[model samples]
Structures are given as C-alpha cells and as structure tokens.
Target: MQLLALQPQRLSAVVRAPASVRLVTPASGMSTYRFNKHVISHHFCANCGCAPFGFGVGPKGEETAAVNVRCLENVDLNAWPRIPYDGRSV
Candidate 1:
C-alpha cells in the first residue's frame, strides 16, 4: 500500500471527527508488526489484507499517524504534492 505522510496537526484539520478514528483488527484475525527497530505499529485488516494506517513517533518525539490515502473516500490523491521520505535512513 502507498502511504501518504501528514503531520498530526495537518491531519486533524483534514479528517472530520478525528477523535472517532479507531484501529480495529478484523474478526478474521490480523497481524501487527514493526520494522526498523520496531518504531511503528503497522495495523492491517486480515480479511482483505489491507493496511489502512500506522502509528509511530515523529522526529520531534510527538505521536504521529500515517494514513493510507487510497482508503479514504472522495480524496483526490493527485491534488497533493508527493514528498519523498527516506524512512529507511531514519
């Protein structure tokens, strides 16, 4: 899945009812794994094997979330500038 990076501040502005967002594992069973020193918690839906989002700490130590924009409805992905992030080097 392609991941779009957004700051928590910006994300809150875009997502309505941000407080209602929750990560739920599917009843069919799903897996949560971490890579690169286990910095982020990657959540995926087992039934469809789709990763809708992930949670991790930002560079400044603030909590951050990376949401898969493709999963969002009515969002024009092309409207946003794509910024390349080299998380592997972090």
Candidate 2:
C-alpha cells in the first residue's frame, strides 16, 4: 500500500531529549555536524579536557561532521594529519 507509506516508523517525529543531558551554554558558531542521530556535541577545554569538534544528528536531523584537531590552537597543527580518533566519547 504505497510501500506501507515508506515506513521509518512511518515518518517519525517526536523530538525532545533528556535522559543523560548536559548543558553549560555559551553558544558560538561553525564546525557543525550531523550523523545517524543521537546528539553528542563537543567543544571541551574547561581547563583541559581538550576536544575541538564532535557532533551528531544526521540522516534526517541534518548536521554531522565528526571533528577533533587536538582541541585546536592558533591554527596549522603541522599541516593537519592526526588520524587515530576515538577521543574517548568526545
């Protein structure tokens, strides 16, 4: 019947999360990301937690990029090439 109306739980939409949330807002921009959906944004260094990027919400929510540049510096971390990611739950 119209391919069951293209089931994906029949066009899901019930957004509202809070079962392990964390917020310490200060908002900025750029380096956005989105992937597979689940939300897990990143931007550490609250004294030395080092993490520059790492985000979520893709395939439908739009905005996933997956990041990390040694928590960033003034730029040019040796021409960028440090692939061994798994930043322990960025």
Candidate 3:
C-alpha cells in the first residue's frame, strides 16, 4: 500500500463531505484486524486478501483514515512527493 499523508481537513475538503465520510467495502465482504492494543483497525478484502485502508485515531484523538493511495484512479503517483517513514520504529 502506498501511503500519502493527508490532513483530515484537506481530505475532507478534497472529498467535499460536510458531515462524515464512508468507505465502500468490497462486494465479497470486508474483514478487519487490529494490532497494538487495537489502536488501528485494518480493513482487508475477504475475496482477494488485499488491504484497502485502515481506521485509526489521530494524535488529537480524532478519527482518521489511512487510505492506500494506490487504490486511487487517474492519478500520477510519481508527481507526488514521497516521504519515507519507518513504520517498524513506531
């Protein structure tokens, strides 16, 4: 999964959701898993076993979604600046 860090406000502005945003699950069904004392909820496609995104609480205790940018359409990934993160350390 390609991770692009986007602020919640920016994401909401881009998506234009005034209230809340909902993610559409795959037709076959979606399975969820949580690690590290259930801090983050990882969502996966049950049929293909591919992860689409994750739901977690932000640093400020706000709900956040970590979307896999690879799932986005009609976008040039190369154009975006890449910020490397050491997930293992976290």
Candidate 4:
C-alpha cells in the first residue's frame, strides 16, 4: 500500500459530509481528543487506541467528517491520490 509521510502534526484525511457517512456501530464508546481545537472532535478506538476519524463543522457551517484512509478496509491504498498539506503551518 502507498501512504504519504505526513508531518507529525499533519493528518491526511478524507473529508465527508455528515449525511454521506453511515456508521455500522454506535460511536458512544470511542475516546475523543480535541488537541485544543474544540472545533474538531477527534475520535480514537478505546481498545486499540488508533484514531480512525473525527467530526467537525466545515467552513460552510455543515457537519463534516475527517476520515483516516489508513484505517479503512477493503481499500487499495496505493491507488489513491496523494495530496500534500502542511498542517503545522495552519
């Protein structure tokens, strides 16, 4: 699988609108970390401690998801495009 080596502070996520995402299980058990950015609610697995996604309001004032592609199953990671982003500078 191909993966981008993002900066420590950078996260290469796929942005999706809230209505577009359907969760298979309830998210009530996940742990959240805001990283001081209360705007985005970063969620990680309580058992594995791996952050798979986040919820936030987009610039357009719509609910959004920040999904980690690496955590997805049945996907060809190498087939995805790589976009560079500098999160540290944000």
Candidate 5:
C-alpha cells in the first residue's frame, strides 16, 4: 500500500464490514492507535502495516469508522479528485 500523509477534508471511501470478519495471514490482523484528541482508534494491519480504517465516537457521541479508499481493490484512484486538507494543524 502507498503511504501518504492524511489531512482534513481529504476524500476517503470505506465499507463497513461485519464484526465477524476475521483477519488472516498476510493481514497479520490490526492494531489500534489514538489520535485527534485521543477520541479515535486507528486500525492498521500488523503484517502489511497499512492503516485500512479507524473507529471512534463522532461529535454526537455515536460510533463511526472510516476506511481508506486506496485500500479497496478494483478501484481506480486516478479517477478521483485530489482535494487538499490540513489536518495536522488541527
């Protein structure tokens, strides 16, 4: 997977998988890290070491998960619009 700095407002596509979905070899499962005021847990593959998505509470106190569009297969990233975001300063 390609490593890039994530910024605010950057478009990302993700799919919500069933909780029953299990991680296998080559996947090496995932690890969580806290960020953005320590309210969110970022999940990444242990083997590939790629962050596929993140989970956390929203402003309304609801659970949410965000997945990386680049992580999905059969998707053409070049066809998407590259928007600028500045999340680091937040």
Candidate 6:
C-alpha cells in the first residue's frame, strides 16, 4: 500500500513517495512533528483523508521527524487498514 505524491515541491514529496500521488502541505512551518522518544506525529489532508507526511519522535530528545508511508501502514489497526486523515492545516 503506497500513497504517492506527484509534486516534488510539496510536503508529500518531502517524504519519499514511490510514485505520483495527491499532494498536500502547510503553507509554512514543519512538515514533520515530534511526539515521543520512538514515535512522532504525522499528518495529512482532513478533507481528502490522505497522508501528506508523518512526524516521528527521534531517539532521546533529538526531535521528531517524518516517518515513511510504510510506517503509517503499521499505524493502522483494522482489518481494512484504512486510517483517517485530518487536513485543517493543509
């Protein structure tokens, strides 16, 4: 399962995508967010419900960073594996 971002300049491209996909990003600020030591906060479009990018906390207090789309797949806990995306900023 891969949600590819088409534009290289968009937040979708900031994170590595396999191929062309829907693009969404914040006008400013970090595309990534920090959460915990091993986890972070990633975000996507609320309207379309797509993963624009993910933010994961780094080791110690280094800071959070974007996790791969594959990581998002792991975040899913349903038989269907479809996660809801929020897009207030995007």
Cα RMSD (angstroms) for every candidate in the order listed: 7.0, 16.7, 7.0, 3.6, 6.0, 12.0
TM-score of 3: 0.66
Candidate 5: C-alpha RMSD after superposition: 6.0
Q: How close is every model to the real structure, measured as TM-score? A: 0.62, 0.24, 0.66, 0.78, 0.58, 0.30
lDDT of 5: 0.59
State the weakest 10-residue window (summed lDDT) of model 5.
19-28
| Model 1 agreement with the true structure over 2-84: per-residue lDDT tens digits | 32354332331122122345645442355676887676776677667766666676666766666666667797766775555
Q: Which pairs clash in model 3?
A: none
Which residue pairs of candidate 1 clash?
none
Residues 15-74, candidate 5, lDDT per residue (tens digit)?
Answer: 343352334433335677886589777787667777777767766777666667766789
Question: What count of clashes does model 5 give?
Answer: 0
Provide the lDDT at 42 for model 1. 69
The reply for model 4, stretches above 4 Å from the true place, is 1-11
Number of the top TM-score candidate: 4
Candidate 4 local lDDT, 1-90, one digit each (tens): 234435433445677886777777666778888865578888889888888788998767888887777677886655767766656776
The best candidate in terms of lDDT: 4
lDDT over C-alpha atoms for residue 53 of model 1: 67
Residue 13 in model 3: shift from native, Å? 17
Please write out the lDDT profile of model 3 over residues 1-90, one tens digit for every residue: 243444321221122122354566552467898887686777777778766667777666777666665566775656665555545666
- Name the better of 4 and 5 by lDDT: 4
Q: Which ten residues in a row have the lowest lDDT in candidate 1?
A: 9-18
| lDDT score, candidate 6, position 68 | 36
Off by over 4 Å in 3: 1-22, 26-28
* Ten residues in sequence with the least summed lDDT for candidate 6: 9-18
- What digit string (tens of lDDT, one per residue) describes model 6 on residues 11-84? 23232332333334451433433443436465644555455455443345454334334324354323323333
**Ordered list by TM-score, greatest first:** 4, 3, 1, 5, 6, 2
